[model samples]
Target: MSYRSMTLLRFCSPIVIQARHGHRMRGKAPDIAKSLKERLAPVILDEEVAKRNDIGFPYQKPPRSAEFNKRFDHLKKQRSDSSLEKAARTTKLQINLDDVKVDWFKTAGPFHIRKIAEHYGVYDDLFGKYAYFVPRVFLDIKFPLNEDTVYPVYNGNKVHPLQAKSVPEVSFEHKFALSYSQKPEENTLWTLILTNPDGHLTKENSEYVHWMVSNIPNNDISKGDQIVPYLQPIPPKGTGYHRYIFVLYKQDKKLDLSSMKVTDLKDLEKRTFSTFDFYKNHEDSITPSGLAFFQSKWDESVRDVFHKELNMKQPIFEYDFPKAYLNYQKQFPLKQPFNLYLDRYADPKDVNKRYLEERLAKTHPFEGPEKKLQFPNAHELKKNIPSWKKTEIRKERLGRGRINDAV
Candidate 1:
């Protein structure tokens, strides 16, 4: 018996045998051509291509394990408990404002303060009035796990770039150290206002109040009542950087803040807050005491904080890539070699020369006569023409199927 027949007989013990004179039976099988074609056929990946072209895959952070969740809850509870206990203790501590002075403003007044305001276009027509009172309040950000450090407040050396995402949940602490020449009086009442002059959508002398405490007794902010509860800085993206100004005013007496136009926190959004106007209106009642400010930008944490804490929707940023790019170009103007070939052959005159002349005319219209354009010498032109003509000839020859002979 054949090997195949023997194997089939072993596997199928109940098979019926048909006897024939020197004849073997064969089973039907698949077509070899058809099988090969199916195996070698090209795969169409249109669906995969479409999926790749569509929106990006959603990134869902993996859920924390039970133990991790428990630990996080415990830490959160501990923080809340400790914060309450600290607040209770802080309320009892006596804060002295008698030694505090607004002299820090004088040191920063000439160039530093103005430069910062000018950088963000925060100054107005009445900038000079409040300029002298710009304070030297030291600001610090305390992170959940890190020690407090001095925040960048108009001082370039110590100025730190605050990332928006990392700071929303973090609270900042500020204290005013008296300048040497000035002394605070015990009977003097003060007002503290923290605002973002560049927070408005439109360029106006407006500000969004982050924190406002009026009738502060002797610069003790913790003891004072909050007119506008502390709203952490939420500098929206694409608005560039924002300046969070902490302005302290020495009130002649306790301000009857009930008469102010914006008495409620809800009315503080995009409020017209001009330092000059405020000083002018209350010139008799309030004097500029101290001023401190820091810059901030949008971060990922802003979305959550805005919606949850501030009860506001996150603003959709308008991408200003072109404007930013133009500004960068202006700052570092490109110094590239002039395209002599294009200038000489493509146009009747040097295009770059014309463009420069036109720009100069617009910049200095009343200046002397237009400067002359000096063209390249004949020797320089002769040196470059041969290479250009050779390239053109080679290209022409290649098009005509005579590339082998052209070179």
Candidate 2:
């Protein structure tokens, strides 16, 4: 959300007070939840704004999918040979996955937002209304942006220009008084209608990029969405932090971002990012914004630090953070370090050594195959069946037979 839009939202939010209680609005679905669903939804049209902008390459044309790859490959071939279109084609920003510096997936949370206006001397602001936080689990990927560096798709500061535009619009309100038949009633969502300050919207399919629905409540102010109050501080060595990016928008009409599915949110996020980029940098004077990428390894020590900072219990498994994290324990263990839940990837050498040791332990000398066979009841039975007894019986039977035959 842009600064100007945020200011406007803060100002107009007061008008919401006059809205009739339970008065149904015409056109759109009455359920506020419907808006909430589309708000964080993905673009799903055959052609999006990004794809239209560049006929050659469709944004997020699934690389693995045959249809996407086919189009992408065909477009690449056309661009390579078309010298006339080279300027525009080459101007687009390109990124490699390897360039990212920090890689993490965490639950979202709302932290660091000021609970009260500084002017109020730490007292909650009277007009404030909105509770917001990032989810507890999310993928936090960061791309470094350097000052004074500008790329076609990314601005300086080593960050993508698209990211800057995709910032979420945030607001607050309180609806605790609203009666609910459900035991756990839903919190009121305070929404801010935002626009592309730079006049750039999604090119092909208007992509919905960033979204965050948090449980953060506002105990400070009354009026507006009061779902999020305050962010809880996890002690250092904490469980890690999640940042919710609220990209708010007010459209002239409802959007079909979701196409009616919860899983579609991912596509919506990507589209939102792309749309923000298009609008933010339409003029080329400034850069559009979006996340670049991050390359981080699974480190137990880092996980421990997160735990300590968040005031969480120490985890038992310490070999690696991502590894132990992915290993699901039989029980839903108490606040184990985040590392305990991450998938661990270690050098092959270490794995081989462990495997051999386990093998040897299973085949130790006392438990060897030969010793077990000799000590068992089979050995006693064999000893009891005397070979000499069997031979004597056979000879006695033969002698008796010969005497009978002679008679």
Candidate 3:
């Protein structure tokens, strides 16, 4: 009844299965090819070329805060997504309160930049103004010591050495001279500003203008007009480390300061300065280009600079640490052992062990209690000696009985 029909069905089944398999393979071919290309792509370590998919590196990183577009702006198209846009695409931040990874913040730094000829500095190469990762140059803030120069570090290394960027200490007497990696363009001027955001209690907003120079032609700072003559950082003693940041800005044109308020150069109130307010007022023209900062703590020179140079009272900051705990609380690891580790998992509204203990003591009067042990007090022996001068009266009494070795 079915021999002839079964033979025809078997022939059609093989053809139908082959056609379905072919359709499925065709549908997945494009995705498979794409993944294959990505897997097989070569990494070029010698030179940096912008990639369309990655926006972390400078070539891909849509140019300065435009983070570094001062020159790299041309490298990335204006139509592409901005750095902030890319940052939002990150569901979770790669760096956190505990970690120190700035590369994951999607900013890439210049690498392998050589120092300006004859300049004996490694930091001059750290920010990479010559190699071009946005920061046009780094400052060579030379101190008395060779290693005190501020160096920038941003090569996407596994370990971000933030301390490398800071100068451990700087002197008050020497005004750190800055050298540039490259000169400004013709007719273009530069401005060098030194500010201390950690002025302790010195300023209204905690910012102190250490130095300011405007209209510097082609990076020769000596030729510029010194508006706020370099005030050697007079951070009040005990103020800790104050970061003196040197920010260089490129002037769109010559700046006219006639309208701006010029505080009397000698006035200590001139110390109360705001770099943001200054930048806000001149937002139209000046563009931040290079940055280098150093840290300085209170030294003896600060006292002399305050009293002798500024002709004012030397502010000494002595933090009076609150005196020792006279009445201490019985916290764990202090006076008691922690037995209830499960307390952490208990409900917040639930009664605590302390309250339960007090309740139990009230209900059953603690059964019975005794305070029977006491040592003879040194104070009782000497009619009230203070703790510091108190002698071990019991030990002295015990020693009197053992006179075998007495001289």
Candidate 4:
């Protein structure tokens, strides 16, 4: 549901308050004042509101098993147990998990492109709520191209390997078309939509050109040479993030992208330089410098068009979640504090311990007599765990006489 609709509905609901009991009264003396206070009572949705909205989520059904019914009855008894509630009320907020920090923003050139697009007059219309026409932020979304597949010939555990083969004959025509009588500044950021050979959509088939103001020369609203990649997405199997960068450079006089109030070309002269050249030229006549800027830099980075997308940063803050199994009694009211104990054994065995260790290293990474010593390697503990061969036999005292024992 849209946020606006939910907000409107909530506004019509009544506010609830708590009241206190009066002191010992004789003959039930009349009270004049009313109290308006919210207490530690569970906030339940009003039945009338629920009925009016036709909302019936998770309706309870009669228990089908006697064992489940007995457990449910036991829980009801626990709800009435005041001792449990008192203990819960004393709990405090405690998060035991190591905090992690990562760069959430990944796409590099989108930053510059967006700034320039804004200067050129159409970023607002084209990009809308998204951070520019292209969202550089990774949202854990995956594509089928990166999915691991096994071949029958090799081991079943390993994914089929792939390599790059230059196929000069395999070429595709890429074109950028823009039409705006409303002036360039009033138009939207250009969007490039890609389609497969059989007309199905592919990841590399999509791209956006946003104005990058920081790199622009004095916020000049100029339309530069259209960008067309000689090579594009090559189908492959892999398991990593990849990035494609596109940079634009305007070769002519500064162009005015602002909307024209008079609908005339008179203001065009004031925007551009007198000596700047303009005209359609052949591909050979034009020279480009930063064409090969998107080369991969890190182990996680790949030059291939088809690869996984990863956020450069990790989630900054986190809180230990409250127990879902515990139906809060009065003692453990809303916003009550609690501690988290690590029951690490319950975690999946395959979880990447190295990743968690790396995050912990950033926080409090060391343990030694010297405070400055670096944190001990997590994997080191596995090898250093006491071995039977390394243990030595020690002599015992007379009172605790060294008897012929298993040791």
lDDT, model 4:
0.28
Off by over 4 Å in 4: 1-204, 208-407
lDDT of candidate 1 over 1-407, digit per residue (tens): 69999898789867599987875645445643356667699967666443422111122222458547977997899677766667667785333442232333223343455466445444443344223323333333332224563233432222222332233221122232243334534465677776776676555656676667787765456676666666666778666666776666666677765544355444435344666666667778875544456666776666766676557677867653432212222323355323432433333334545655544554554775434334312223345566655554444334432222221
User: Candidate 2 — worst ten consecutive residues by lDDT sum?
Assistant: 120-129
Using alpha carbons, what is the TM-score of model 1?
0.42
Clashes of each: 4, 98, 4, 25
lDDT of model 3 at residue 365? Answer: 50
Candidate 2 lDDT, tens digit per residue, 79-125? Answer: 77666476556885444453331121111111111211122211111
Report the number of the highest-TM-score candidate. 1
Cα miss at 353, model 4 (Å)? 4.7
- Assess candidate 2 and give its lDDT: 0.30
Q: Model 1 Cα displacement at 78 (Å)? A: 50
What value does the lDDT take at residue 94 in candidate 4? 40
Candidate 3 lDDT tens digits, 1-407: 49889888878755344443433455456735667667689866533333212111122334235446543664555337476457767754243632232333223322322122113222222222222223444444432324444433222112111322222221111111123323423455777777667674644544676677788776566777877766676667766665666666777789976443345755767556766567658868876655555555766667767777678898878677645534333344443323332333344235354444543453545554233225533325465765322333344334431121222
Minimal lDDT window, size 10, model 4: 164-173
